[model samples]
Target chain A: MNDKVAQTVKTKGITRRFLIIFSVAFCLLLASASTHYFIVERSERIERETRELLNIRLGKAAIERDMQDVISDLTFLARHNETSGIFLPDNLDARQALAQQFRVFSEQKGRYHQIRVLDETGQEIVRVNYNNGEPIATSETLLQNKSDRYYFTETWATEGRNTYISPFDLNIEHGEIEIPEVPMVRFGTLMFDENGNKRGVLLLNYLGSTVIEDFREATANIADHAMLLNSDGYWLSNVEKDREWGFMFGRNDTLAEHFPDAWQRINARDTGQFSNRDGLFSFTTVYPISSSQGNLGDGLGSLPADTSYYWKAVSHLPPQSFSASLGEFLRRNMPLYSTMFIFLAASSFIVALTRFHHRQAVSEVETERSFRELLERRVDERTDELKTAQVEKDLVVQHLIQAEKMTAIGTMASGIGHEINNPLYAILGLAEAIRDDDSREQARGHAGKILSYTKDIAAIVRNLTGYARPFSGTEHKPIDINEVIHKAVSMVKRSLYDDRIEFRTDLGGLPGFSAHSEEIHQVFFNIIRNGVQSIEDDGSLMITSRYDGEKIVINVKDDGKGIAPEDHSKVFDPFFTTKDPDQGEGMGLYVVHQIIQKYKGSISLESVVGKGTTCVIEFPILPSVKKGNP
Target chain B: MMKQKILVVDDEESVRETIRLQLKSTGHEIIEAEDGKQAILLLGQSNSHGVSVIICDVRMPNINGIEAVSFFRRDHPSIPVIVLTGYPDIKLAAEFVEKGIFDYVVKPVEKERLIAKVEKAAIQSAVMNIVD
Candidate 1:
């Protein structure tokens, strides 16, 4: 009982060990794998951010170089002696020389599209137009603007002589795109004599196409979405051409307008990059904005405050830029991945094995239970079979007893009939003889013979009726052994006589026994009748009774054809017979043996083939106890 | 019919004597034997009287009526046998009669019926056209 329990606990211990090992291995693999993923992700992110920031600064520097070139060209024009000679009291020769000098300056330096000199009244003092490939100074008649132009008014409003750079846009002539769509910006600065005079503004129109074109060329080789937006988040240049310069065209579709959430983070941080599921966006305020470009002060120095009015450059890298392949990471850490996989697989296999064994154990238990039930059912069936067999055996025994009684009666019936029949015949024949006899002597003699034959029939009838009647005597009585033998012989003598056999009874001095006399008589009768039937003809039966020591011995012997050796063993068995079915029921010796046994007597036979048979019964002088009628 | 000769066979002496006495009043001759074997032997003798009819009992120690009749059938084909029995075993009696026995009579027999049966058997024997 406890053995199975202990085995189950042992099995549980082995499985639990595997379970704990699998759980710890699985958790450790998961933690390490995730940690490696985060580290790789963060490193890739920082590398990509630094590359984007460098590209943004590159784009801003291009724009600033174009602005510095315009300012240097304007300052060189202002310091020329031909331009200051105008303040030396109008010498015609000096004025003509200045015109010639301006023409030559435009021919030599062709980056400027237009150059002019204006006084405080916004008059063009001297102008030169670079037409085609050469510059030509305009006559005095073509210097038309007095003061309405913004570059002229914005410069004259400055308290000190200071330089101003105009916003970059597509050049428009009379509210229409200029021929060939020239992108331009105007540079204006106040001009004054050596000490303190407030002179007019000198301005130049610079070509802005080179800077925007350079930004586009730099971004063309890379897959990153690069855009350049100004201080107000207006797109200056975008990889998508439609998004650029929207604020300049009054559309104002800026980066802040499209992605407000990203703009909030971008507005708070400078020179930073972040990643989201959609894409990678890196931005930098390369030239930081200080105050609004609409306001200006007296200071004209190139201070930090002056440089603050500048544009921002932004680059959009797509989602692929931020995440490196986890596959590549796994390839580098092949042993680690393989270990985790093997652990998981082994755990799964163990779990499956445990489940299979659990099912097997359950099925085995069920099989045992079913087998026990079957055994119980078989035991019940066997018990029932035994009971039924016992009942059948009881019925067989009952039938055997009834058959034995009928057999005894049948064996005696024919002999009894012959006994009665012979006498009847003698009586009928003698009665006729008597009636016909006239002499008294002869008639009297026939009548006497008839009376004796009648007596013979009466004796036979008495014996038959006595035997047929249900016996009421069961008590043991003191019986003369010789008397019982004589009575037994009387019943069977007629049949013996009919067969031409002689039955002689010799009665010796025999003591009486306490027994059922009729039963003992039956035993004698059975042997004598059997003796008579065994003879074919001229046989003799002899019955003798005597006392020997403590036993009373009765012998009935037949001088007839003897029982065969093969049949001797079965002669006393019930239903064993050599006689015809009509003649006997064949239970004679078996019943005789049983009756002798009831008195505690034993009967034995001795015989020789073709000689004779002898049946000897020896019973005690007294029975141990009286038996009821069977 | 030449005054028919009758043979009576019985195992018992009293029955034979009674049958002899019974046939004495008749003018016909009577012959007797103790059993069927003696009756058959008497018929087989050269000096034996001509037995036209035989009355024999079935229950006898040696050569009972059935054997005597069945044996005499081939030897004395002209003679007819009548079966008489003390026990009324009609099936056996009838079986013998079917094999050309003259008649069957049960014992404790009526004398009148016995005499009539004997006369009929005598006449039957005389008239039988058996080749012998």
Candidate 2:
């Protein structure tokens, strides 16, 4: 007896151990799923941010290309003697001619700041500025004396083959004396004579703020920071210049320190890109400056691409910047972690509850063992209780289905009503006018007839309203099936007809029958319309109806495109339209199925992809009730 | 006898045809234009002379029916204009009425109702002609 008790105790302990282990495993699984969800969400956000940064970088690169193109055009035009003649010693004829040319160039480009010509020796010859009549300055000093300047040295050394773009400066002046102060970013290109002799340099200065302004205007909504930097780590343009570039430049640190191997590669190869430790990615492209003048060289002597234009290097910053505020980063990620933590807590609670329940069951089993017959009787009672529970569950399911149907019907009714009301207003207005007109006898007679017809219109409206909300188990009535079909087709077609999809009706030989006409009409309309949409290209839909002894058979078939076999069964499921979620609620076929079932009809579908789909509906015909002569 | 000219304005050719067919039995001359822009050009050219009434469908692509009616009232006050609309909102109806629209008709238009409205508009126009 002592050994039997020991065995029972050991069995109970083993059961308890199993319950605890199972509960812990289940809780761990739940926690793992929650963690995975958090990780996936975080990764998606990071990816989106990375893409945005890439787009911004590409946009900036395009803008820079355009600026270079403009500069090149100015350089080419300036090489002509007729173009440079304006810069010659204050000759009225030449100055006026140059001013006219400048006006045309400015009008065409919409943003050229000034055009200036410099002698081969680097002395300013003549200039036209866009500062609303600012005074023009000439270099009295010898051009040879200032050969060290980038504009002069590059032009002279490259033998008029290079163009120079100057950095942003505040006090640059251009054109006539009366104009306002022009804060300019200047560019200069050399001009060579036909004999290859260095002639002069053509300089164009544009508003620096305007260049940055255009970029900012184009990307006003982008949230990421954008900055322009030189190979020497000089800040070119930044929205918050002092905060971002100021801090970096003040430290005199190589970009390699901040960007790591990526910056090192960019400097080594003149172009490189990499993602930061935090997964912030960056792309950098560098174009070599052929001369100290910041001039891009032309395709002379194996210079990378055409350097005759200013070489530009572009780079996109990574999505996760080390410079991001710790507070903001934490805030953005808190939701994911919080969700995971909540899931963990819930799972733990469930584990605890399950452990308690298992202990209770063990204790109950021990107590029940003392009354074996009583326990068997209790089990029988429990089985009966389970049957009652199942019945209740079925009732709940029925109620849920009804509620869902009502909700769907309500939504569809609102959409249809809104669509129908527009036409109804026109009918109402025309009818009212007829009633008010007391003109010629013939006209008045016509008006009288129209008034009666409008009453028929009101009746149609009433029918539509009733049809939109048919009660469950409503008795089927004798209805003209052909008219219902025509009405439904016309209703849907009138609203959606466009250049893309032409509605073609092959509706032939539809017989009049007795059934719930409105319901059947909705079913036919929904199915036919769906078929029409399935054929995206210009296609034809053939709808045919025939009487098959005791039943009416209707077939809707499309010829443009067909549904995949896998999706065929899913088409009739609720919220399962192949159309975009925004365009369709996917409930059309589901509603049609419900209506057909309600009217004791059966619907079947057959489809072949790239060929077409056909839907056949069969409905029982009801006997018509004749109205007594009234 | 001169054919009674009827001006029809709708964005849709099919909708215009639906009305045209219903009015064909009346033996009136039917003139159709797609939108207010085309209707204005036709009216300006006097291509639809002796036009008994103008029937315009609202919610057209460019200028709507109510706006077209207002334009007609301003340019040709003697011409009675009817506004046809699918939307029967009270606010829109009130706005059309204020613009001196001869009538407003709704869509899925009852064929007979539309005919009667057109006939009444024609008679009113005739009475105005007699008064003038």
Q: lDDT per model, in order?
A: 0.70, 0.60
Residue ranges of candidate 2 with Cα displaced over 4 Å: A1-42, A45-49, A79-92, A103-113, A132-148, A159-161, A167-185, A194-196, A217-224, A243-262, A265-273, A277-281, A286-630, B1-132
TM-score of every prediction relative to native? 0.45, 0.36
For candidate 1, lDDT tens digit of each residue in A1-630? 899996886577656666776677778777888898778766866666776777766765666555555566666676554246664546656655766777777777666677887766777877788785578888877777759878788777755544666766677878786867677767777778766676667777776666677665655544247777766787777767777677657887987787777776777776777766557777776442133221223244543446545666678876664444566677777787787679686975586567656766887799989999998999899889988996786466434544654566665554565556666767776777777767889888888888888887887788766754543546777777687777777767644324467778787776557776766777777788788878876878888877766787778889889999889989889878888786577777877777777678899998888999998889875444223222
Candidate 1: TM-score of chain A is 0.46
lDDT of 1 at A585: 73
TM-score of chain A of each: 0.46, 0.42
- Which docking category, incorrect, acceptable, medium or high, applies to candidate 2? incorrect
Model 1 chain A worst lDDT window (10 residues): A288-297
lDDT of 1 at A59: 68
